[model samples]
Target: MNVAAVLSCALLLAIWGLPWSDWLGHFPAHMIRHMGLVAVVAPLIVLGFPRLADPLALSPLAGAVLEFLVVWGFHLPVLHEAAMASSVVFIIEQALFLIVGLVVWAGCLRTGGLAGAGGLLLTSMHMTLLGALLTLSPRVIYALDHAGALQEQQLGGMLMLAIGTPIYLIAGLWLVARSLEDTKDEMA
Candidate 1:
């Protein structure tokens, strides 16, 4: 692997080692770490080891749906609470985040056209919607243990918007432009 790729892998491990709850409170920290995994780390890994993605045969649409389900399912009140309550559950949750992230990124990177763009765009939309809900909610949606203060919950949502939304949206748009260029090139 290239130095950059090795560094990114190390960074992923380092992020998990951080005491996110102590640094940014529970909810915001979790949100930031989650975003970092799926948005930053996952893409870096895909870019680093493109061949590693070959084993995954998921379509862009299916990859998006899988990612969406994993994210939302883990964020559900019951599951969220369990994760917060137990180290095992928390580890499982985090592992899944990384795994699904790799899958989605691999699929998108492999299929850099309308299919990739659409999947990424769809992910961006759902991420935005989820973030908005968390930010705008009057009452805390998740358990108090993980959600922390209401303000903290809102901040977490804001973090998601700040991190996940732009990354996915920009990636999608870039893929669309790439697709157009490829088509133009083929016609020439």
Candidate 2:
């Protein structure tokens, strides 16, 4: 847990540092940095938190679904355009991303192994699809600059695919391993 806390703090520093830097705050960096918060930092916070029972009370799959909606819905061109159009909307979008991300990770961490793993697998697949969509799109989806948007989108997608996808899969596999251990204990 202490290790988790340390990792969380490190991720936060990275997240906060990006916006201050002109070079790092751009398209692919911004998106990729946010993913670090969502997929890694948030999970570490959850696993490190002193009280785990609160989030564990909810259904893991429900959290996963909510995460899917929040992440996918917010990232879409229409919604992202709205966020970009206003500072308030952008703040809200980012807030929801962090909050929902925490909930989903907590749920996956605390729920029964099988349910968590199953939900995680589904989530990974959904994220994979989203990444593919972004990566394969020929035109720039966002109105941010329109020129470099395609390359940026593809980079963000590649980040999701290369980094985000593996986190979910590894977490799911870990849950599966835990499940097997518990089953063995019960059988014995």
Quote the positional error of residue 33 for candidate 1 in Å: 1.4
Tens digits of per-residue lDDT for model 1, 1-188: 78658966887877788788888888998898889988888888888776775666377888889989999998898998899899999999988988888888888878879999998899899889989999999988877754348989999999999999999999999999999999999999
What TM-score does each of the candidates earn? 0.94, 0.89
Model 1 residue runs over 4 Å out of place are 145-148
Candidate 2: list runs displaced more than 4 Å. none
Model 2, range 96-169, lDDT digits (tens) per residue? 87777787777777785999888788878888898888889888777867466678778878877887799989
Candidate 2: residue 105 Cα off by (Å):
1.1
Model 1, position 18: C-alpha lDDT score? 79
Report RMSD (Å) for each prediction in the order shown.
1.7, 2.1
Question: How many residue pairs clash in each candidate at the backbone level?
Answer: 0, 0
Best by lDDT: 1
The top-ranked prediction according to TM-score is 1
